[model samples]
Target: MKRILIILQKEFIQIFRNKTILPIIFVLPIVQLLILANAATQEMKSIRLAIVDSDHSPESRSLINAFSHSKFYTHIPVEGGVNVSIEQIDFGKADAVILIPKGFGEYLIEGTPVNVQLMLNAINITSAALTHSYTSGIIQNFASSIGMETINVTSSKPSIRHWYNPELNYKLYMVPGILVVLVTIVGMFLTAINIVREKELGTIEQVNVTPIKPYQFIVGKLVPFWIIALIELSFGLIIAKIVFNLTIVGSIPLLFGFAALYLIVALGLGLILSTSASNQQQVMFMVFFFMIVFLMLSGLFTPTESMPQWAVLFNKINPLYYFMKVNRMLILKGSEFSNLWDSFVAISIIALLTIFVAIKRYHKSV
Candidate 1:
């Protein structure tokens, strides 16, 4: 215990002494949190729409007016009709084109079915899909107002309510995931890099020759980073609350408790990487490779449910996936520990596996 504390003290001294690591530890995560929470969003706004109205009738004019009044669309005029609108789409000037064919007003007057063609630039699939949905909603609402029955509806209109996030603010969704990323980076990357750096400088040899056991050494290496990562999480949550106006619906102590266990999984993984790698470069590359895979599979931007069956199955082993789910559930939904027992058990198992591997992999050699 005393030896472990001494090593822990030594690790802290070394971390604080490094000039570059201080910025990475304290500054970079904060900057990324502030920038990414705002920048990384799925919300679509200001869609450029081109309307080709061949009819020149009041009904066509009203349809165009409906799109123009929407906050999501900006109407671009095409003088040469559908051909010009297609050209605009090809030139990247328009996201979607609404072709209001001739006799559109006549068909509506005759109470006949009228078809309005919608052409979308599918270069960006997500944008095109969102544009299609937005424009379709506007057209349906316009048709309803003009007493045009596009579809014979026997069912009542559904009362839609968005729970957890009533406003659907993207930041509220992104901040918790980003916070997990930052904490993971600190716990995993820093631990691996610091240990590999010691290996490069021949410091590990000196430590190995000492009276420290392998488990003690691994525990010593793990504790400092574990504490630092928790501190990082605390600071990140504070920033989330103050800057993003994020509200924590769950218990802060419960969040911290989960974070403490999650950090063990991350830090132990780092320890394993550090034990296997001989240099900082090797460990850094490994960290990057793992980080990319973990982030993609973690459902940070997209839900894991939307992924393929194979991906969903493989995500069971991903520690990030469990923590990401747990973080959002706790912070956004106010989920209790009882509600997250499976995640807790999964993370605990991963923590034990990683620590055991890290201890076994670290060789105490002169």
Candidate 2:
């Protein structure tokens, strides 16, 4: 008890006093939370759309008005006329082009099919998808409104519903996802390199030769990190609530429970890496490689369903994927344990595996 207490006090003092890391410990997560959360979003807004109103009639004006009124488009003027050449859309000068062919009003009055070309930039797949969805929605609504006003056709009214995020504000979806990233950084990167730093500085050897148990040493190192992580998480959540107006639909206690589980798994992963690494650089690189894979696989930026079947299967086993899912569920969907059994089960399994690996490696070292 005395040895563990002494080691804990030493670790705490080192952490609080370290000139290089103390500032990072206090500021890095907050900065990342503010910047990345704001930047990372599923919805693409303010798309630069080129207008080619060749018709120059009331009908074309109305169609253009529809886009302008919506939150999606920022209409850009064409040089020659409203109908910009194909070159304009192709060269990435425009995200989308609304081309109203000549005599569009004649076709509208005659009830004839008018070809309105919507050229979209497909290079940015996400922006393209949003553009397509927005354009399609606008056209669908226009057709329906026209049909309802002009001709009474006995057709069923389409009911549109959005899953997960109904309003699709973007920030609501990103806040929780960013929290997952902060957790990974604090638990894996910080702890992994810290352990290796002690090893490199010859401090670990001095401690290792003492009467302290390996578990005691590991726990003493881990506890301070865990406390610091909790503090960071609190600050993150508070910021999320204030700046982003993020919603926590699930129980706060439940979120903390899952966070605790995730922290255990993360610490174990860090310990495994720390035990195996010969130096801090190696630990950092190894953990970074793993983190990249984990972040990409997590369904934060894109739908997990959109990934290739093999990648989807691989993501099922990814710990960060589960963490991301849990956070989204808690924040957006108000998901309970009953609503998230699959994610809970997967996270639990991963936590066990990491702990087992870490313990095995630690014992081997001792």
Candidate 3:
């Protein structure tokens, strides 16, 4: 324990003495949180709308007026007709085009059914989906205001209650996710790079020649970083609360407690990668591969349920997947400790497996 403390002291000095490392560890994460927390959103506003009406009647004008009045749309100018509007969409000037068919006002006047065509740019699926939903909703409200009779007499309107996120703010979801990613960046990349830098500088041989055991050396290397990451997380939580109005409904201690275990696995993985590589560049390429794969499979931006069965099975071993899931549940839903027992158990197993392998792989002679 004494030897480990000495090593820990040396590591902290090395980290803080370097001016570049300090900012990378602390500043970058906050910047990313501020930027990405706001940027990665499911909400769509100020849709670029184009209307091409063939009838040009009062009903058609009323439909166009409805779109113009709504907060979701901004109508852009079109020189020609529907073809011109379609060209605007193709040229990236419009997001949606509403084509009011001929005789639309006549059908409405004669009490007959009429249909309007809606065309949307589906390149961004979420934006497209929201635009369609909002546009359809406005159209339906207009139709109802005009006293259009519904065909279904028995259909009942269902009330929807969005629990935990009533305003559906996207930042609430992204802040926690970004926090997890920041911890991962600091823990994994720093551990791997620090050790590998020592190896490249030929300083590792000096340490290996000393009386330090592999387990002791590994613990000494990881413990300081574990504490530093926790401090970073606390700082991030405070920033999130101030900037995005984030709330932690679940136990803060539980979240950090699980994070400590999760960092064990992350740091161990970094150590194993560092031991395998001859230089920092090789370690970087390897880290990049693993990190990209982990981020994509972690259900951060996408829903894991929508994935195929094979991909879902593959994510069972992914540490980020479990961490992301648990963090969101704790922060958003205020899930209890009992509800997250499986995640805690899974991270424990992962920590044990990875740390065991890292220790066994680490040699005394470097």
Candidate 4:
């Protein structure tokens, strides 16, 4: 225990002495949190829409107004007909084109079926799909407002409510996930390069000849980073609350408790990589490769349930997946430990496995 504390003190001294590492430890995560939370979003705010109104009637005008007034769309006026609007899309001037047919108002007044043509640029399938859904909802709302019985469905209406995120703010969903990613990067990458850096500096040989055991050495290496990562998580949460107005519905202590365990999984993975790697460069490349794979499979950007059956099965070994899911559950949903016992158990198992592997692989020799 005394040897471990001494090594921990030495590691802290070394970390603080490095000017470059200080910025990476403290500054970089903050910058990444701010940028990624805002930029990496699925929500589209400025969808350019071209309108072709052949009818020029009050009803047609009202329908056009609905889209124009929406916050999601930017109206692009075309001089000619539907073909001209298509040209606008071809020229990259518009994302979608809405054509109000010549007898749209007449059909609506006569209680007959009216057809409004909506053409979207399918270059980006996801964006196109969202635009289609948004436009369809607007058209339906417009029809209902003007009392178009033919367009109105059966009288039964579904009471739709968004539970966790009532306003559907993208940042609310993204910030917690981004926080997990930031913490993972710090814990994993720093620990991965720790022993390798010592090896490079001719310090590992000196330490290997000392009386320190492998477990003590590993604990010494792991604890400093574990503490630093928790501090990073705290600062990240504060930034999320201040910049994005993120509300934590769960216990802060619970979030930190899970974070403490999750950091072990990450730090142990790093230590395992460090033990196997001959140099810092090799460890960095390995860390980068695993980081990308873990992030993709972790359900950070997309739903894990939507992944292939093989991917879902493989994600069982992914530490990021467990923590990402748990972080959001605790922070956004206010879930108790009882609700997240399975994830906690999975992370605990992974932490133990990684520590065991790291210890076994580390050789106490020059």
Candidate 5:
């Protein structure tokens, strides 16, 4: 224990003494939290709504006015042609295009079903879905106001409610995922880069020649980084609350406990990769490879259910997949331990396996 403490002190000194790493460790995570938490949002703001009004009638104008008055959309002026509206979409000046057909006023006056065309940029499916939904609601509401009764198959009108996040704020979903990203960066990149730096500087040989056992050396290196990563998580959470109004509705202890375990898994991977690789570039390349691949499969921005069956099966082996799930579940849903047992078990098993592999693979090149 005393030897490990001495090594821990040495690592901290080395970390603080380095100018480049000091700012990265102490400053970078907070900035990422502030920027990325807002940037990764799923909500659409001020959707550009384009109108190709060939109708040129009171009803067409009224429908356009309803859309203009709605908070979710911004009307973009376009010339009179469906092709013109498509041009607006192509030029990135509009998100959705509304075609007020020539017969729209006649259809409305005859109490016939008026068919208005809506075209959307469906590149981002979530944004498109929302834009479609908001616009459809405005059209429906306007129709209802003008006494256009529609027939339904069922008498039951369901009042759908969004629990946990009533406002459907995207930041609430993204902040936790972004927090996972920050923690992963601290635990994986810094640990890997720090250890590889020592190797490159020829300082690792001095420590390796000592009588210190592998576990002692590995623990010494990991303990300091582990604490620093937790500190990073804390700072990120604080910023999340202050800037995004994010609330942790679940047990804080549970979230932290899972974080501690997940950090072990992340650090172990970095430590092993550092020990295996010969240089910083190798370490960084490997980090980018794993980070992108794991994050893509981790269901951060997209749902894993939407993936192919084999891809979903592969994610079961991914540590970030488990951690991301648990964090969102605990923070947003206020889920209990019972609900998260499967993920907790998977993380623990991965942590133990990664730690064992990392410790076993580390060498002083004896």
Candidate 6:
């Protein structure tokens, strides 16, 4: 027991004295929380809305005014055909393009329906859809207003209610996902290379030659990193709550429990990598590659259900996917273990398997 404690003390002191790693462990998570949370918003605001006015008449001017008056849109005039404005939208020069046909005013006066083309950049599907829906509502209101003034006719009623996110605030949706990303990056990148770094510095050989058992060495090495990772996790969640005004609609204790399980899986996977690889570079490359692949498929940025069936199959093997789901479920859905047990069991099995393989590999190498 004393020897194990001594190993822990030695490992902790060494890690604490490493100036390069402390900043990354303590400073980077907060920085990413601040910068990414600010940039990764879902709310569509001041979108560049361009107009092609072929009619060039009072009604066209009215249509332009309709778009300009809306808080969501920033209207810009395009001096060409609808196609030209659409190209601008395609190239990301504009978010949306509204076109008024040549006979817009004449047709309105003649009681003939005039066609208006709305071209939107669907790259950001949520924002583009909202912009189109809001623009359509404005146009429908204008049409009804014109009908009431120029003709006596019943207008089609328009009613809108946004679901889930009533305010459509991007921060609310992104905060949970951002926290998942930070956890994965730190876990996969830092943890995987821990032992490999010792090997590079010749300390792994020194430890192997010592009286310390593999279990003692492994536990001692992992304890500090595990604590550091959890600390970063806590910092991220606290910032999410205080800075972004995010809520923990789910059980906070349950969330941390699942997080603990997920961390074991992360650390185990890293142990496996470090055991198999002889040097730090190989560990870094492999860990980075896996982290990228997992993060991309984890639905941190996109919905997993929206992916293709085959891609969803790949997501099943991804530990980060389960972590992402658990984080969001706890933060947004208020989920308990019953809602996340299947994922928990799978990750637990994986963790055990990796740890077993890692120990075996380390034994063979030593």
- TM-score for each candidate, following the candidate numbering: 0.79, 0.81, 0.79, 0.85, 0.80, 0.75
Candidate 6 residues lying further than 4 Å off, grouped into runs, are 48-70, 75-126, 133-163, 364-366
Q: How many residue pairs clash in each candidate?
A: 0, 3, 0, 0, 0, 2
Candidate 2 has a TM-score of 0.81
Colliding residue pairs in candidate 6: 42-170, 250-334
Clashing pairs in 2: 52-82, 52-83, 53-82
Error of 5 at 23 (Å): 1.8
Candidate with the larger lDDT of 5 and 6: 5
lDDT of 6 by residue, 11-98 (tens): 7787789888888877777788888878876677898988888888898798788778878888776877777888887788899877
Q: Which prediction has the highest lDDT against the true structure?
A: 4
- Name the runs in model 3 displaced over 4 angstroms: 49-71, 75-119, 135-163
Where model 1 places Cα greater than 4 Å from the true spot, the runs are 34-42, 52-66, 78-87, 99-117, 138-173, 249-251, 301-303, 306-309, 332-339
By TM-score, the best candidate is 4
lDDT at 120 for candidate 3?
Answer: 89
The worst-scoring run of ten residues by lDDT in candidate 1 lies at 151-160
The true-versus-predicted C-alpha distance at residue 127 of model 1, in Å, is 0.6
Q: Put down candidate 2 lDDT per residue, 232-289, tens digits, no spaces.
A: 7777898888888876878888888888878878877898999989898899989998
Residues 132-209 of candidate 4 have per-residue lDDT tens digits of: 767777777788788764553223133234589754577889999999999999999999898888988888888899
TM-score of model 6 (CA atoms): 0.75
**Which lDDT value does model 6 have at 136?**
67
Error of 3 at 163 (Å): 4.1
Q: Specify the poorest-scoring 10-residue window by lDDT in model 5.
A: 150-159
The C-alpha local distance difference test score for the whole of candidate 4 amounts to 0.87
In order, candidate lDDTs are: 0.86, 0.78, 0.85, 0.87, 0.85, 0.77
